[model samples]
Target: MTTAIGNPYLEGNFAPVSDEVSVNDLPVTGTLPPELNGRYLRIGPSPKGSGETGMSHHWFVGQGMVHGVRLRDGHAEWYRNRFVRGDVPEDSPNTNILAHGGRLLALVEGGGAPVSITPDLNRMSTWDADGALRAGFTAHPKTDPATGEMHSLSYLIRPGTEELRYVVMDATGKATHAAELPVSGVPMVHDMAMTATRVVVLDLPVTLSMDAMGRLAAGAPESGDALPMRWNEEHPSRVGVLPRGGTADQIRWFDAPRCYVFHVLNAYDTPDGSIIMDVVRYDTVFRDVFRGPADGPPALARWTIAPDRGTVSEQIMSDYSVEWPRINQAWAGRSHRYGWFGGTGPDSLRLSDDVSRDRGGSFEPGPLVKFDTATGEASAHHFGTGRVTQEPTFVARPGAEAEDDGWILSVVYDGTADRSELVVLDAADLKAAPLARVHLPRRVPFGFHGNWIADNEIGA
Candidate 1:
């Protein structure tokens, strides 16, 4: 059998790291705040060594590795990287790293169960939520700030099943709600939105193509080089709202226009009973993509669902190419004014929405986008040329008064030097200089979501 010469995902900065290192008392530029006491942990896919390199390596598929910075008592304590166990066994946990039920969980939406790890970045065990979360779980699961309940719409692709499960787990590591929802075809449902009374699920145009999968399994050359999923132009786009803690049969489905959302910023319900949500929408996905993301760029869009009127309306907020919308987690499942995102500037790498078989082009991340939903404004913080950043996590100051009273934490990779630094910026003034920079020994490639686990909240 012959193989393609190059795959974009396996080359350049997207390449996997060769080793995991533990460094203590990393150098710091500015002062670390005393109130910021906890671990800033981020997870993403990173295959080990050159053997994992291939033309078929999608950015979304790899072994998951957790890179963390320990913050405690006004000092940057340590930085460590570890491979998550039990999922791919010898591969990547590459998706989202989360803190739930007193354990750190590594999640991937595609078909692997959550791999629980220790607070200090040690491998623990594969969890099924006490036999509650079966099949597999998604990378993004929303937790209710009011009730401490975790909600997930997990999907499993068997031979002849078109059903997915909606499972909810309470604070103490116990599964409380489990129900199955019907779907016509298997879609790559990456993320979901949670409101006070409902969890929003997207059934978009991108669905699994068994024909493509069969070709890959049958040793089709290019099948090993591209994603098996394809865009279904005829598939209707829609959103389903399931009542919090309600069974799958109770889900209310509303028709939506043709689009796709990979991550939701924040969502809430109006007093008039309409659900309002902010998401990063793409015109198409998995249709004519290169590595992992949608072929077209994404925008910050709003979707308003009226249960009484039986209509779902979408409003595009900003056309700036962006994804990975994050707000203060405390404001999740409720209304919030501000959110942060990993956005692209004018010269950033972009994908064409048209179909192309050959590997096309690539670009680095542009700026950290600070979006104000209330004022309809977006400000970008550029990190110089060849320097890219990942999803910015908002860390609220203890005893914070205003919603924007916090610091934004992100791992900024300097492509020139081939090194990474954890940059902290004032949440209120995103354009300002970094408040502090915790330099690391190596680069942490651009990856998925993370959390700032307050020391009081975890046993690290």
Candidate 2:
């Protein structure tokens, strides 16, 4: 069964799977690494029932479903898919998943509480750090590798909410500090960046739209069932750099160039008192389509924010279009040498209106790219054609000292076979063939971020 006739997001690899099946002893094509002793879990919108269709159905509004692959003792142990059951299951966290603080968490942005799940991917309950999350948690949280504390910038999307919160969670997964930073508009804060001493807040141009809300409330045809956020040209784009646990008054604001950023690769503080950040940048989003992002083929860019001069210098790091940029978690909030991303094209950027007319792109699969930031050189591994690759999560080799000494795990969907496989590549050699491939029973739909939760990290 398919979704709305021409809704691209509801068709192809973006389509939702109806069954929640568990299959053990999956077939493996190559030798699995014995050290990969844990789970590779990914979560995304998998809408329930065929009742959801039409222009109102958006890509980001589907139910949360998690797809997991377990590896232990050099074997593909099992593969499972389960729904993140909630009071309103459709609104459950579906953007990212990770094991932190001794519990596995499914996460989302825009004022949603983290849904704690068992290590095996079953929903438990809404987690608020023993009731520390007053406003909610963000999908993207930066962990301080030096201190083991996780930090994020969270915001509630509403008609009158005019502030964003800076939250910190200790190594034990308890909410340690949270501060409400006042702002003029309720911006869509998808991700945040952190350094040794401060947290970077993105106050871009995309904001909550009351007009779209009124249209949806009145059941207008043009008002789709997506989040009501639009590109507010009047809203000034800026970045607030504040001390890790600092209050609003302590935040130093700088005017940023007009643009929107959905993901930050990494950030760190320089000796000159400037914050250096790398991010996937979009020119403008939510302008014509009320659904998901319909802007540029997002490019990797770097921003140098000088607090002393109160200015920001923006530089497009590469002309190559990409998304879901990731780095070594061990180097989080610090200088890094390598970054991995899924390649995209201009055809992938389309609006809902275009999708209805059969003009949207499927975000077709491109090469998996590895960027050498220090040398401005890149290498790629193309998985032929018609194979969609998601974000490449980097897992370092045990006791490895080099930054690129690791493996890159990504979920790739083979269109010809109508199935998916977990591809493991050597980070040091992107052009080389995959190290291993674990074949699965079904195609894991294109989705957002996830991680390699080792046994030690989860105490499993």
> Number of the top candidate by lDDT?
2
Compared with the true structure, what per-residue lDDT tens digits does model 1 show for residues 1-460? 1122556665666766757899998899988878898899988777654334565556666678889999877788899998777754732456888787778887887568888888888666788786776577888888998778899887764445587778888887798878888887787687888899888888888777777677667766252233566678877789998898888778988998688778889899999999999988877766676456636567788889999999998888875677778898789988999999887534333334222212253323567988889888988788887777879999888889788899999988887898889999999999998899999988887677787888666565
Query: Each model's TM-score?
Result: 0.93, 0.94
| Model 1 / residue 192 / CA error / Å | 1.0
Note the clash tally of each candidate: 8, 0
- Candidate 1 runs further than 4 Å off: 1-5, 48-52, 87-92, 221-227, 345-360
Output the worst ten-in-a-row residue range by lDDT, candidate 1: 350-359
Model 2 stretches with alpha carbons more than 4 Å out: 49-52, 87-91, 221-225, 346-365
**What C-alpha lDDT do the candidate models reach, one value each?**
0.78, 0.81
RMSD of each: 3.3, 3.2
